[model samples]
Target chain A: MAAAASSSDWPGRYHHIDQILDKPGPRTDPGFLAGDGVKDFLRGQAKILVIGAGGLGCEILANLALTGFKDIHVIDMDTIDISNLNRQFLFRQKDVGKPKATVAAEFIMKRVPGVTVTPYFGKIQDKDEEYYMQFNLVICGLDSVEARRWINATLVNMVDPEVPESLKPLIDGGTEGFKGQARVILPGITSCYECSLDMLNKQTQFPICTIANTPRLPEHCIEWASVLEWPRVFADKKLDNDDPDDIDWLYKTALNRAREFKIEGVTWSLTQGVVKNIIPAIASTNAIIAAACCNEAFKIATSSAAFLNNYFMLIGTDGVYSYTFEHEKRQECPVCGGEALDLAISPELTLEQLIETLTERQDIQIKKPSLSTPTKQLYLQAPPQLEQATRPNLEKKVSELVPPSGEVTVTASTLPFSLSLRIAYTS
Target chain B: MKKNEDAAAKKKPKTSAAQIRVQKDLTELDLPATMKTNFPDPADLLNFTLTITPDEGMYKGGAFTFSFAINTNYPHDPPKVKCTQTIYHPNVDLEGNVCLNILREDWKPVLNLNSVMVGLQYLFLEPNPDDPLNKEAALEMTKNRDQFLNNVKSTMRGGYFKSVQYDNVLAR
Candidate 1:
């Protein structure tokens, strides 16, 4: 494998580093660094999209040029921080704060002139139809589960609609400390991401301890099943009416906790700090995941390779690497089963289906009548306080109105009142 | 309406953390004379224009323009790029989509603007259609080599391109 990469020769051209090194007069030519075969491979001009420009993306991208993948597109919505320098080898101390996609593209172009790089320097959600169709393959290096699921659903669904027979493969890879897992979705030939999610959901049903071998929370403790009642509590006392007692309790229990929860979950926790916590080891694990994803992608693009239609996992924690072949034609699986051929998911129908299921659920019903509406919404024009009470209810209410989840927040002050009247209709 | 208003109300600071980094990248950029960079809007450092005049190969004498849009997320992400100019190339789509790896899927934080510019230049010198932005272009180049060459020549010569009017400048 190492033999494939030829030694880099200084082609005697002015490089990016040369500018920084230039003392005064003439610019120093650092010479070119493309392997002899690099030019040949890049000559074909394959357009590839790397979803995340994180640590894994950096290593994989560097290797891509050496391997001859020239026309590359990168999509990442993140900034180089002081912390990322450890293993995100593509960046330097000077690159801190620059856009990763722009900087990465620039870095590759300076070293190798025989390649074209474009950067979709925004969140993947910002990508439109033109953005999605431009690239041939999408190499997912994103760390967020939401991002991974979005990519899988969007790209795979888009490909299926436009070219069902040639549904594009989505290679989602990630690392958790010492462990990395990559799943390849060949669309028709194998289980798609949704199918994989179903499998995970099934695993959860078999008792968490059985699957993960970790102890579950004690049954006695309240695990925040619902905050729905809190909205009514706040409304019943009218905290906004400046009742000192009502305000104190609200702040002590609900308001303070909610505020803290938002900050903890969104600002600090949402960041891919899990990967950052382990430093080079986690980053290296991420890089391995990326390589595996790309390897699987290459096979899908060119022709069938050994690891086609399989889920490969590398556990650095246990120093083990193994793959589990997912049955391509599983009658038991709902996503890729025989029935799915006719009931294939479409992007247009996906949102509608999701909304239908969300609203149809018996759990989420807003109270009717003007008196029952949350006083804040009635006065300040906000979502009812009840809407913010529980996670599932909140998600359902918001997702019913809007298509996407994980971004929007619903609080108790946003929920509606008149529960008795609303319950009468349901009962 | 509230969401839209909230989004609109949020003032994007004149010098965002990402923009500051881009400025640094630009100052340190060792751009060749053949390649020049321009900011369409001085206020928006995130989005800029790149003009490339190839000194050699099939795209010689032809000028190409590309648009670069940098998200607020800097150095840790790749910038969005599109071909602003319509050109006859297998890797570039009629809609101004480019077949660049770093921009798409192979980008790393370690790579910078300098690397991307060089890659764009490479596309001009040697257009790769294998992972083509335009599948038709790739198919023609791979399966019908002669027709592909003719199409490229005609487009370069400022002739009618598939019934669509295009301004063509001769190659050096």
Candidate 2:
């Protein structure tokens, strides 16, 4: 097909996209200019990064390539699994165990002909700001909340008020079963993923006693097998969640427990789902969400149409319901909001207790947090020597450690930006 | 053989985050004079037993023992606390389940081992009848305080109350 196509055929291939760029409409972005420069910028110079290569990622990559995005880079650290073939359309049976990013990139570049897709088979964290800054925009098809928060914080922190190019617009898409959402985040301008942490459902947990002694539900029995029985039976060996043998053992154990309790409804699939915390994914849902994300990306890239205000939610489970609304930015958001977040805490709270509160807080959930003030380093979670030296600070009262100014800075392993907290001592 | 044994020993799991936090909490524990903590396995800080002997409550002269089991997600999650012995109390059921607010809905990561110890102590000091695990005890305490006290005294002294046997938790 590449040999049959001539250079003259390239312009005709993108004729539909050229029509939008060549003629401006009433609903176009305010800064959009009607000319060939928009198309030239999109096809010639624009560099976009697509994070993740599963489910929605394959669709997003295809949509971008078909919409005339030429230079694209994708990063994914996951390897191809047999289960991913149902929704991730880029790989075949022979491609199992290969990196998703590399396979997806190769597939896209081969089919699209004119587009170039570079793949990095590594974590998004491995790339520094220098790599991320080179891209004009980013599209995330990530399933992990932590990865989304990391990228959102990174883009938000990269924005320099003086440099316009440093502000990378992040378009994020997520799908769970028949429900999904796509949102446009102009870094330092719109509601980031961190600002909407409460929108996610809290993970459900079974009580220890119910699972240990009186399990009434199938899930309870499964938890008993995984949480209590697994450790006791295999004390030295860690249960590999991905290994089928381990899952089979857990399933057998849970089935026995359920039989003893006279409870029904324990199946192999349910056991795997419960153990792996699987969310049902449909290819149609991924396509719908990815198309929404790519539509926003095209608008942001070509200025052919007005981009989504902020958020678009689609619910296909209940007769194809959809809604678009602006998700407001939180002023106290730790990533992109004000100078400092006001935390009301008791004066007697210890530094360790404060770190724990930060870690468990719903809105600002940070893992492995380290704290410091202007005058001294209160505590550090890393570099064994420093952690050992600052270990005693964890026991001291917050009032004793904090200065009169009531300002403390916190850094976490999961976050790309430092959080400034202003302590408001509660009586 | 010595090198291989050393390697195997090193391969043993390092202290988890939950264990580290529990150790920190145990180290800084400021238990009152009436309370005592005993770790059956000193190396395993994740599981321990706490004995509370209130000095000046209605339940004075009674020693209540509770087993604390901290899981791997600690601080993020509250410890599993259960009464070691079933007794006649409003918040403690016959199956040894405790219904402390901090252990359930009101559990925040800011709460420490010390806070839980204090909360458990407060439970003995003031057994809240409003929220009860044992409804009969709650009803008895609410309807007739004198009879409730008698039932508690009898139950604490290793007697039968309402056809259920009770262990003698009285201080020796």
Candidate 3:
């Protein structure tokens, strides 16, 4: 059946489901046979929702397509640009100015004919929940922590409230610089993304850094690049009539170098024509990270996998990558609240419900001692074992203090190196 | 040289949006003459090499090689960049992956090549362990600052990271 669907002629020959087995040609590239390898790994015919078409999404789409995933939906409100060429390999110059989804779908159709690619070209809204319900697995390839936090809360309620014992939610990706990390959120079986986010947020301030950290970035030794518009730039230079072969290297060098000049601190308008140079290599990391994501997702989809839930897959440029696992130690965590089903319910809770239920109730109260994350000035000098070993204990202790589904932040250590803990009422 | 020629020959016309954007970036690029672009193929503008000899930072003594692979769609998209050279820093992965955000979500078409190059260079002087590509490195940098510094020192001298030897690295 898989072979009939994947053969080059499979599209033409197998018009009906009954004609699945009779087709021949050694299945040519035997693409469906590839899918057949892991068909049993999937929990029924699962629908997949991809959230971006940038560097990570491009690689994820290609890897998934090559892996023979048939029912896949991608959402990205972006157009193809010259800057993307550094990492996104799916489109070409001819494809510039076109919708990324449309071109991406066409590319897939040419490369792998059987799979269906639906493109949602717009900002993903709360109303998009109806479309999100169709998928069993949600792969987040976005670059924003706010978006990530929102998706975590929303998907839990929409996709599977129970946070299936067997299923794992995988967030595989890297950020602007060289930092790349992946984590697996197993709803009921392990700590969900929200629990991790709450913990990470209260303790380390990972959210604000990932969101507002841009201006803080020092320039890369390499640079971000800009797009090139031909015929115009050329004609403007009065080169349209010049012999193409006569383009002088020395003269071109001076002209090109001139393009690199910029006036710093000039009002924003003064720097208008200056182009940014983007490093293509960092763009490639998106592909590598995406491949790793698909590989892990495939493993979870096919086998009863281990070693992934609530762990960080950290990658380095020198090819150094490691998986650091952090498991929730409490049966009823103050942060995660025992991975309770109610924790995954509806992103519709209002401020009134939260304030009346949380503030007025005896069971609830915000516990804010002081944020003492590992990076905090207070926790700088403490022994690694002191903080690392005490994390679970601290989490349990704090979770017990906060109300069910309420949040808390704790800081206790000396100056330079203090440890902090943040707990959310997930139970 | 022949391989260079072949790579160059395989370069298709810069029709991909990425190539066009790169070309535009190059045309308007603002770099010291010390920086240069090597197009193994004028046709394959997306995949090219960059050479930078930093005048500042721990990487000041060294010359680094980087490979840039642009997506078919140029300006609107972020380019995939990799460090061809192995540098010991919290942000750069051992496999040559960098941790720059402008190339990721913060990316705007308005950003050009100089921004990324400067960002990559800044990594050499001060690696941000808090926002790390290698969490262990970040952890170690945060937890064991001296040792992290030592590891970086040894690696740059063309020694080993963990047990892997990176002795054949090229000089700038």
Candidate 4:
């Protein structure tokens, strides 16, 4: 394969890499460098994974493919739409109705020869740890904050203290129209996404009073339809936001409310936007952010340059501007930092009661929880055998099974990050 | 090679949230007679053209055309807009990349094509000399208001200002 790096088989596109093969990056471990030199290492074996083949994903795939990455995998659950034509630049109108990951992979494979592009047209959660562990690095072009948090925790959990070679670098990019940000996250090194969770503005939440009693804005009226009207009209049914009928019903109901209140500018788009909480995205912003993210990924992979210290914010409105600075990691971050949190709970509280109590708490919003002590499984919320074996424990006092004070690791899919709690029982 | 698929793609019947909203918005279209929108291809709802003739303002009696490209992900994402004409204006550039805040950062799902149209109309009635896309036009307006008005007149008359040639925009 090293011979292939020199022969006619070598991709002519990477002709400029000969100058940088001797240059070493900040990483010193010989194990981190593949086979022989940097060129052979980057062009021969580096495995890269891209999450979300939407706006940023398309650009990242192209950038990585042309940047000398050998093997790449893209995962996205979205389908191509007519609207993606302006900025995605990969998929043509003919590619509509196809999975984004599949189409993006196909498009890249055809355009960039010698590079293998694998596509996963499924949810990120569906992929297991073994799958992600194969990748040298992960680049996220995702739109959802929850999805990013899940990937961040998953990558952080994969970092083994004994194995320095097992470290996985995550480069994340996000955009809202003219504004965008890209950041480098070296798990247990730089600030993980959760470490900078507060940096994300708290998602806009409509007050119940404004939504119910005084519906002034179109958003307020939409909230009223979903939060109040849905329950009142269809007591037995759950409102499916994806359903056009459900949206139409909300639009009509909200518009009627708006008319009564003499509020202007109540439209179907606004109703849909309010219900789904859509963020305005721009193709240009996605392109800019993706380029920065891929630049960091390429630098991290080849050591061509130093990676971003931590974060870079790009603003494209009014000419253009960008700023880069390191965002510090929090010491108490549940995923990568500190020991189990110490919790004081009454010994008389049952396991089910504790679960209920945790659900009510904003910090630990696990509607269903499975708890285990340091040695044995104390209680599980699922599986017939485990549920039956732990059924009595749920009814019994917390002190009887978990003891007064010890560390317990809690697992739940709903949680943004995993929890390890030290139970300090009270009288 | 993908022509067959592309032709087939031109046949999808799915109506997205933006499409539904665009339909509703057009039916309720309350634009002044000076502005008009055209959909050359009924099958393709994402792209369209809007022509505006400013009845009054610095560029009054001049007709300007702008193109809008709305993504299926519309409402969540702002539409791609271009001036389509070469003009000397403080808000729109030579390449047609307009610098309207509503078309960029200030855009919301609540705002539609009508809102964008209104914004463009307002741009003519009173071109924002504060936040300008063409800085030269902005500077001219700030330093010498009469020269700026004369420059606008020249731009509409197919003349050159600051060495930037503009296409004649006045109605024949």
Worst 10 residues of 4 chain B by lDDT: B7-16
Assess each prediction's global lDDT (C-alpha) against the native.
0.53, 0.80, 0.50, 0.74
DockQ of each: 0.01, 0.06, 0.02, 0.01
lDDT tens string, model 4, A1-427? 7566445354445655544545454553344443246777677778899999998999999999888786899999989977777778899999988899988998898888777899999999887666787899999999887688778877876665666766899999999879899999998888898677546653476644346555688887888788667876886798887687999999999999989988888788888777877777787788889989988887788765667898999888878998999998876455565444568899888878877887788866665666665445556554333445567777877777765445566655454334667576665
Candidate 3 vs candidate 4, TM-score winner: 4
TM-score of chain A of 4: 0.77
| Candidate 3 C-alpha lDDT tens digits along A135-195 | 6566768765556655554444333333342243645465444556666665444665545
Worst 10 residues of 3 chain B by lDDT: B9-18
lDDT string for model 1 (A284-331, tens) is 787677777776665444332345457776767665666666635443
Q: Is 2 or 3 the stronger prediction by TM-score? A: 2
Ranking by TM-score: 2, 4, 3, 1
In model 1, the runs with Cα more than 4 Å from the true position are: A1-42, A160-166, A198-281, A304-307, A327-427, B1-172
True contacts kept of each: 0.00, 0.00, 0.01, 0.00
The digit string of per-residue lDDT tens for model 2 on A252-358 reads 99999999999999999899999888889999999999999999999998888989999999999989999999999976455676444668789999999998898
Q: How many residue pairs clash in each candidate?
A: 77, 0, 130, 2
lDDT of 3 at A38: 42
TM-score of each: 0.40, 0.66, 0.41, 0.58
> Interface RMSD (C-alpha) of each candidate?
24.1, 14.3, 27.5, 24.7
Q: How big is the positional error of residue A5 in model 3, measured in Å on the Cα after superposition?
A: 4.4
Q: For candidate 3, lDDT tens digit of each residue in B1-172?
A: 5334323322311112233234335434556644566666533445777777666655566667778877643444557677776666667656666777776656655566778777766676677887776566778889988888767656767876787665434354
Q: What is the lDDT for A139 in model 4?
A: 99
Candidate order by DockQ, decreasing, is 2, 3, 4, 1
